[model samples]
Target: MSKILVTGGLGFIGSHTVVELQKEGFEVVIIDNLSNSSINVLDGITAITGKKPIFEKLDLREKSAVQEFFKTHNDVKGVIHFAASKAVGESVENPLLYYENNINTLVYVLQELNKLKEANFIFSSSCTVYGQADELPITENAPVKPAESPYGNTKQIGEEIIKDTCKVSAQLNAIALRYFNPVGSHESALIGELPIGVPQNLVPFITQTAIGLREQLSVFGDDYPTEDGTCIRDYIHVVDLAKAHVVALQRLLAHKNETNFEVFNLGTGTGSSVLEVIKSFERVSGETLNYKIAPRRAGDVIAAYAHTEKANKVLGWKSDLTLDDAMASAWKWEKHIREQ
Candidate 1:
């Protein structure tokens, strides 16, 4: 069995992708520093998948350590790069950290992959690259507006880095999935988003407030131009987003890529307002969340969702979960974690 390397495979989306990769019969090895994530995620993965993957707690930011890893595991056929600091507000407070963690580590991973006879790379990208597209249902070809925050800037730059590398190296093939918003957990309730400190994303905050971890949920703003005057975003299930990575990796490994570099927008093609999301949670969890509208944050966009035509036709993937489903699973996982 050919082995695949998943950086930050213990984190939220990475852990789900690791589970999907294992199910596809691909030998998997995971490298994580356990900075924002914990080692207990491995037990959750094993409990659901009935197998444990090879794991190394290595920091990818160290160029020397990354090269040593590739030398030690020369059989690694592919790389899924997901390890990075990913909070928009946090990035604004510390842009240097975002640049170092996101950009520097990407360069190191690509350098190691360029040495192999052939390599397949999947990049964890974000929809913030579109930056409030002028057109509704942002397509892959939508102009990448200036990133609103340092975290988004890293993704935009990372895509460009991969594209430029693929142009020069015939042995390197890469795909970047511009994820909109990944929420929810695996249906088994084993692993889910467990952010350290206060949660930045909406779903986690909602769950925490419902479970009494927090006093209230701040809706960010109610003045955005929308039905309910709140920002709207496409919220795809994390498991669905993880499956897209596997499909993308398989496309590169099978030599089916039409180009050395490709980009796809991974989302459900449906946009939901923040108020709508809270209502869905109320319906699913049967709790009216205590939320108040604060002033708009600096980096938030009014709306962004995927067109999904290219991803569906080219990548043969589409999200299959709803906001209600996501809210239910998230509520279940919150209870599970709190009960422990």
Candidate 2:
């Protein structure tokens, strides 16, 4: 089995991707600083996958540490870069933190990978790179507008960095998966989104409020131009998103990429408003959530979903879980953790 390096492997999407990769007979080495993630997540991943990935509690910001990691794990055949500060609201207030953590780490990793004889890279890009898309369903070719937040800008810059690096480094093959909102947890009710502080994402906030960890879920904005007057996003199940990572990795490993660097959008080709998400949670969890419409947040796009035709056809993968399914799993995980 080819060894794969999963930066931030203990994080929400990263842990789930590690599970999928391990199940597919790939050896995973995880490097996480444990800033936004918990060490307990390692146990959850081991429980679910029946194998514990090799883990190193190292921060990627230190260029020397990153170079040392590549030296030690030179056998690693591929890299899935997911370690970064991801909150949009936080990034708006602290732009330098986003740049330092997101941009610097990416450059260091790429520099080391460039030294390798062959490198397969999967960048954990976000749909925020599209900013406020002019079209309803964003495609891979959609022009990246001015980023609304520093977090979004980092993703845009990260993709550009990979493209430019791959252009010069013939040994490096890369793909940027610009995925939308990922919700839900594994069916085992283990290894879910464990935000260190107050939850940043919508689904976790909804679950926390219902479980009494929070007083009320503040719906970011209710004046957006939408059916419910709230911001809209495509909420794909995290499991589906994780599986897509494996598919993309296999594409590169098999030398199936038509070009050295490719881009794909991972999403369920549908959009849901904030109110609609709350309704889905209520329907699935049988709990009435306490929420109020708040002012529109800065760095928020009115709406964004995906066309997903390219991902479906090129990667041969599509999201299989529905909104209700994701909400139910997330609710179940929330309850499970509280009970413990």
Candidate 3:
């Protein structure tokens, strides 16, 4: 089994990916600073996979520590980089933090990968790069627009950095997965999105409100030009997104990449409004959510979903879970975590 390094492996999506990788017989190592995630997630991963991956509490932003990690684990066959500050609102307020955490750390990691004879790299990217696309279902061929937030800008810059790095580093092959909103939890109800403070993402916030952690959920807007007059996003289950990472890795490892640098959009290809999400949560959890229609949030697109045919036919992966399924699993995990 080839050893794979998953940065931010203890995070919501990262933890799920670790379980999937372990189940696939891949030796896994995790690097997380526990900034946005907790160490206890390893237990959830172990419970599911029956194997605990090697974990190191290291921040990728520290260039020396990142290099040291590569030195300590010289046998790493591939790297999946996902340890970045990901909140759009927070990024708007703290732009420097987003750049340093998202961009500088990426450079440090790629620099270390350049030292290796050969490497396969998978970058955790977001669909925010589209920035309110002109078309209904955004495709990989969609022109990259000006990012609406600092966090989105970081993803755009990160992809550019990888493309440029891959151009120079002939031995490196990388893929950037521009994923849509990722929700849900592992079916075991052990690991899920554990936001430190108030939840930034909608699904977690919805769960928190239902669980009484929050007074009420705020629907960002109900005036947008959509079916529900709210912002629409393609919410794919986190488990499905994790599987896509594995598929992208296999493509790079098998030398199937047409170019050293490539990208794929991961989503369910169906847009769901914020109100619809709340409705889905209510249906699955059997709890009427206390939500209010709030003002439109900054940096939020009216509608953003994916044209996942590329991911479907090219990467051989498509989202299998719907909004209801994701919300149901998230509700289960929320109840489980609260009772713990």
What is the alpha-carbon lDDT for the whole of candidate 1? Answer: 0.94
Across 1-340, the per-residue lDDT of candidate 3 in tens digits comes to 9999999999999999999999899999999999999999999999999998999999888899998899999889999999999998899999999999999999999999999999999999999999989998999999999989999999999999999999899999999999999999999998999998988889889999998999998887789989879999999999999999999998998999999999999999999988888889989889999999888887778999999999999889988888899999999999999898
Task: Report each candidate's C-alpha RMSD, comma-separated, in the order given.
Answer: 0.8, 0.9, 0.8
lDDT of 2 by residue, 1-340 (tens): 9999999999999999999999999999999999999999999999998998999999999999998998899999999999999988899899999999999999999999999999999999999888899898999989988888899899999999999999999999999999899999999998899887898889999999999999989998887889989999999999999999999999999999999999999999999999999999999988999999788887788999999999999899999999999999999999999999
Clashing pairs in 2: none
TM-score of model 1 relative to the true fold? Answer: 0.99
lDDT by residue (tens digit), candidate 1, 1-340: 7799999999999999999999999888999999999999999999989999999999988999999999999999899999999999899999999999999999999998999999999999999999979999999999999988999999999999999999999999999989999999999999999899999999999999998999999988888889999999999999999999999999999999999999999999999999999999999999989998898988788999899999999999888888899999999999999999
Ranking by lDDT: 2, 1, 3
Local distance difference test, each candidate:
0.94, 0.94, 0.93
Clashes of 2: 0
- Which numbered prediction scores highest in lDDT against the true structure? 2
The stretch of ten residues in a row with the least summed lDDT in candidate 1 is 292-301
TM-score, one value per model:
0.99, 0.98, 0.99
